[model samples]
Target: MINNNSVTFIMAGRRQRRRRWLLVTGLLTALACILCCFMLLLGNTIYPVNEVLRALSGEQINGVSFAINTIRLPRMLTGLIAGFAFGIAGNTFQTMLRNPLASPDVIGITAGSSAAAVFCILILHTSGAIVSIASVIAGLITVLLIYIFSRGCTFSIGRLILIGIGIQAMLNALISYLLLVGAQQDIPAALRWLSGSLNGSQMDELPPLAITVLLFAPIVILLGKHLSMLELGEQSAISLGVNTDMTRITLIVSAVCMIALATATTGPIAFVAFLSGPIAKRLVGAGFSNALPAGLVGINLVLGADLIGQFAFDVRYPVGIITGILGAPYLIFLLIRMNRKGDL
Candidate 1:
């Protein structure tokens, strides 16, 4: 009963699992610290970590406290929350669809939000909570449309993505039409939204978004075991007593909510959703799921992009543009590699 080879194999497996866990924990901690540092250094008034800490502790140093406490803190926190939510949500969709390219931004949810927000901004002259509500509704509608359109075939991932691409094109065209038709004075706001700026995200917008993400992310993570179990193909999963359709619908709705909330706050940050999961899987050696690590990577990506956009260039650009600049090439590389492996 006590075979040496079996004991060694068990020991090796435990070691590998332990190592992966340690790596994930370490990466999460490091990325959080890095994001904190970036937030401290980002704005025009650069404050050192010590000063930022003192500010958090309610100490003022040359108005650095005000700058950090009042302005940069809210912006940075919003970015972190939005990025983390989008990342986890994106990976969940990808895992659900069993395709790396499946993400909320890719699958029309973000585009839907953008179109709704653009309409509100250009035509209704609505700002504040109305826009967020409309955007979330549009996002849900888009998700429902995708489901209805693909209901005939039991929903293939390929068809879903193709449908999403079509929807995205139409939404973009509508946004273009709105921008072209709107007054010159309002074009700035519409264009700012289209370009995905976090510039004016105030303290008020942060609280609800932060609460939503905090409340839902753990729920999604708790369902991670079911997600992974369902990933073993639908028939196999069904055989294992999983309610495949219900599971898929639940995950899809949860993921869409996360993306909608994030897009409402940050105006659809680019590529952090598309990039985080794969980067996390590669970093953590790919055995267990990468949901949490993907979320961490997302936070790092958004924080890093915001820092670069804020300080690296002479003119400050939106973080989304910076992410587009940095992430496009990485995406291209991933495509090329996938093509080489015949996965494209």
Candidate 2:
């Protein structure tokens, strides 16, 4: 009962989809690159591109050298790496759980990191590496707790999501309580971090995050085929020879580490994680792995929003504020649509 015409049409459609994915992915990469350049070149002094390049090359372009090498380069690198981590990790959770609301931002993971970082800053009187280390550890523990609780009868994605939201609320309340009880002088630093600013990014803070991403991003991508199968639901994925438990565990740990490291570096840059996956999904369409594309979208969002925050208004805003402004409306729309479809 097979027909050549139908087969031909399907092949053509597949080819077209591939083309679209390539085009969109390439465009996203180009935009991210442009934004990175702008981050380096358009600070208070506005160094030219050639000057930035020369400074990066260690040629020392007078005033441009310090600003470019010390401030802008670190900031740009932080945003780039952190954005990719958030994007890829977010997409992994969303795709694996088959729910947009499963993002770490919505599901308590970032809250775990934030809570730990805040504790370090306010209670322990810590500043640098201690806060980052505590954040990563706390994030991992949070995921483990969520998994254990959600596995009562069987692993249910809905149950995991609900529990994550509940945990997020509890952690947020804890954060508030800590803020209230902490020293008044430490409050400003904690608040600035909670707002997710890149105001004082430094080169020394980049290594752990950069190294984690370099090691884990490929693991996530290499597992992308299995991830797509997970979208077919657990039973179907098992039938298709996917090691659902191992795959999910690998993905969750890898993503959490990446995102937690990012949170450690950038203080949870709002919804770059939440927004990147859906945007990449929309841009790339179906049948292609979205992990890389989502990362690229995240890079663009962070860099673009940072630029907008810096220059678009009289007073500068953090990247999180701008991304929150962009993501909130989309979240509202998605909730409404999901409600109508009975998918909420």
Q: What TM-score does each of the candidates earn?
A: 0.91, 0.96
Stretches of model 2 off by over 4 angstroms after superposition? 1-7
Q: How far is each candidate from the true structure, as Cα RMSD in Å?
A: 2.3, 1.5
Best by TM-score: 2
What's the TM for model 1? Answer: 0.91
Candidate 1's C-alpha runs over 4 A off are 1-4, 7-11, 60-62, 336-344
Residue-pair clashes per candidate, as listed? 0, 0
Candidate 1 local lDDT, 51-101, one digit each (tens): 888988998777887788778878888888988987898888888878776
Determine which window of 10 residues in candidate 2 has minimal summed lDDT: 43-52
Residue-level lDDT for 274 in candidate 2: 95
Alpha-carbon RMSD, candidate 2: 1.5
